[model samples]
Target: MISLEHANRIVGATLEKGKALGLKPLTVAVLDAGGDLVAFARSDHSSAMRPQIAMGKAGGALALGVSSRTVGDMAADRPSFIASLGPISRHGVIPAAGGVLITDGNGTLLGAVGVTGDTSDNDESCALAGIESAGLKAKN
Candidate 1:
């Protein structure tokens, strides 16, 4: 479980890392193991779709039990299969980076963090930084 405090910390740290890296304004969404939003934040000047994109990234990861980067790979390998999931999934599926599963030290699934508003690689970096700042482990 991701407490509200942890979720907030992750959001803050994610945005801070994005700023530090000179990336674009970022939107972050933290989701519990059940794929429910725990915390979310969108920086000023972020596009309107950022919230949905962030949620989709995290929700897609949770739904598949893998990082969104892996989801992207899967999408690349099986485009039709990945596209078929969009309509059936509650949060939709975003096959891109910046969505990472969170785990405890014992490797227990806790939650996930999703980030958007920059390049996929940069967003993923911010997500990892946020998870680490919260003293949480990122499921590889």
Candidate 2:
């Protein structure tokens, strides 16, 4: 279960990591196992669209059981199918990096964390750091 507290911890850690790395302002979103938003945070100077992008990444991770980076790669290979997915999934399918699935010690899926604002690799690193800080596993 992804409680609000857990979700917030992930967001805080992600934001702090980005700050420490001197990355751009970030927006983070956490989603529960049921694919519902549980927590979110946006740093100063971040774009207004960041929150939406974060949510899309989180939703995409939960829906596909993989990181949004993987989704982006897959989409690149299947543009037409991926294009149709946006509307079919109600815009939940964002093919980008920075989204990662969260799992417990036993590797049970708990939820996901999504980050935006920096380069895709940096954003993913932040999300992974957050998940690890929460003493959870990051899958995909």
Writing each residue's lDDT as its tens digit, candidate 2 over 1-140 gives: 88788888899999999989999999999998888788998888888789888988888888888999999998999978876777766337888899999998888899988898999899999999999888888985
| lDDT digits (tens) for residues 1-140 of candidate 1 | 89999999999999999999999999999999998899999999998899999999999999999999999999999999999998999788899999999998999999999999999999999999999999999999
Candidate 2 residue 15 C-alpha distance from true site, Å: 0.4
lDDT of 2: 0.88
Best-matching candidate per TM-score = 1
Over 4 Å off in model 2, which ranges? none
- Candidate 1 residue spans exceeding 4 A from truth: none
